[model samples]
Target: MAKVLVLYYSAFGHIETLANAVAEGARGAGAEVDVKRVPEPPRPAHHAQAGQSAPVAEIGDLASYDAIIVGTGTRFGRMSGPMASFLDQGGGLWAKGALNGKVGAAFTSTGTQHGGQETTLFSIITNLLHFGMVIVGLDYGFQGQMTTSEIVGGAPYGATTIAGGDGSRQPSAIELDGARYQGRRVAEVAQKLHG
Candidate 1:
C-alpha cells in the first residue's frame, strides 16, 4: 500500500475538518495515511475555539512517504507563518531530493471568496516543486467545481473553503466532497507510482 501524509496548519477548525475529509478519502483509496499538523506558538484567541488537535509532524525524511498533501489557512494570499516555517525546515530533505517523484497536492482555507485561496495553494505547490515532487490537483471532473448556486470552494488548482472574515463560516458538504476527491486522486496516483 502507498503511504500518504496529510500535513496542515489550521488557525480555526475549518482546515482541520477539510484535512480529515482528505484523510478519509486517502484511506478509502487503500493507502496508509498519517494526518499531522505543523507546530505553532500558542494563540489563546485562536485556541479558544474548538479544533482538532494533531500531533506535530516529525518529518525526518520525506522519502518515507509515497504521497504528501499539505493544507493551510491563508494569510494575505500566502500560507500561514507556521506552515511556512515548517516547510522551511525541510531543507535537508530537499538537498537530498528525497521527495522527488512523490505525489504532492495542496489545499487551503480563506476568509472570503477572493481571499487568496489559489495563491495559498500555489505557494504550497511551489514548495512541493522545490522538493521535485509530482504535483496533483483537483480535475474538472469533480462536480463541486461547477456549483454556482451556493458559495463553495473547489477549483482545478486545489481544494478550498471560505471561512468568512469573522471566521464563522464552516466548510460546506460540497467543499468537503472536493477535498475528498483530491485526497483520493492523490492516493490513487501514489499507489500507481509507488505501490
Candidate 2:
C-alpha cells in the first residue's frame, strides 16, 4: 500500500479540520496515512481557545512516504511562518533529493474570500517542486469549483477554505469535499507511481 503523509499547520483548527478530511480521503484510497501538524510557535491563549491538540510532525526522512499533502494558513499571501519554518528545515532532504518522485499536494485556509489562498498553496507547491516531487491538485473536475450559489474555495491549484475575516466561518461541506478529492487523487497517483 502507498504511504501518505498529511502535514499541516493550523492556528485555530480550520486547517486541522481540512487536514483530517484529506487523511480520510487518502485512507479511503487504500493508502496508509499519517496526519501530522508542523510545529508552530507557542500560542497559549490560542491553544486554550482551540481546546484541542494535534500530532506534531517530526522533521526527518521524508523520502519514505509515497505522497505528501501540505496544508497551511495564509500570511500576507504566503504560507504561515511556522509552516515555512518547518519546511525550511527540510534543506537537508532537498540536498539529498530524498523526496524525489513523491506525489505532492497542497491546501490552505484564508481569513477572507481573497485572502491569498491560492498564493499560499502555490508557495507550498513551489517547495514541493524544489524537492522534485510530482505535483497533484484539485482540478475543475471536482465540481466544487463550479459552485456559484455560495462562496467556496477549491481551484486547479488545490483545495482551500475561507475562514472569514474574524476567523469564525468554518469550511463548508463543499470545501471539505474538494479537499477529500485532492487527497484521494494524490493517493491514487502515488499508488500508481509506486507500482
Candidate 3:
C-alpha cells in the first residue's frame, strides 16, 4: 500500500480537523496514513495551541511518504509562520531531491472568505514544486465548490474553510467533503505513480 502523510499547523484546530478528514479519506483509498503536526514557534504567553495531539513531524519524514498533504491556516494572506519555518528547514532534502516524484497537495483555512486561501495553498504548493513533487489540487470534479446557497470553502486550487473573524466557525459538511475528496485523489494518484 502507498504511504500518505497529513502534515499540518493549525492555530485554532480548524486545519487539524480537516487533516484528520484527509487522513481518513486516504486510508479509505487503501493508503497507510500518518497525521502529524508541525512544531509551533515561540509565541506570547497567551494563545496556546489547544488539543493539538499529533506527534510533531520531522523534516526527514517527508521523504518516506508516497504522498504528502500539507495543511495550515492563512496568516496575513499567506502561509502561517510556523509551517513556513518548518518547511524552510528542508534545504538538504530539496538539494537531494528527496521529495521528487512524490504526490503533493495542500489544504488551508482562513478567517474570512477573501483572506487569501488560494494564495496560501499556492505558497505550500510552490514549496512542493521546488522539491519536484507532483502537485494535485481540488479539481472541479468535486462540484461542492460551485454551490451558491450557502457559505462554503473549496477551490480549484485546494480545499479550504472559513474560520470566522474570532475563529468560532468550524468546517461545514461540504468543506469536509472537499477535503476528503482531495485526500483520496492524492492517494489514488500516488498509488498509480508509486505502485
lDDT winner among the candidates? 3
TM-score of 3: 0.97
User: How many residue pairs in model 1 have overlapping backbones?
Assistant: 0
Ranking of models by TM-score: 3, 1, 2
lDDT of 3 at 16: 95
Task: Write down the lDDT that model 2 would get.
Answer: 0.89
Tell me which residue pairs clash in candidate 1.
Answer: none
**Model 2, stretches more than 4 Å misplaced?**
42-53
Q: How many angstroms is residue 166 displaced in model 3 relative to the true structure, after the best TM-score fit?
A: 0.6
What TM-score would each prediction reach against the true structure?
Answer: 0.95, 0.95, 0.97
What do the candidate models score in CA lDDT, each in turn? Answer: 0.89, 0.89, 0.92
| Model 1 spans with C-alpha error above 4 angstroms | 42-51
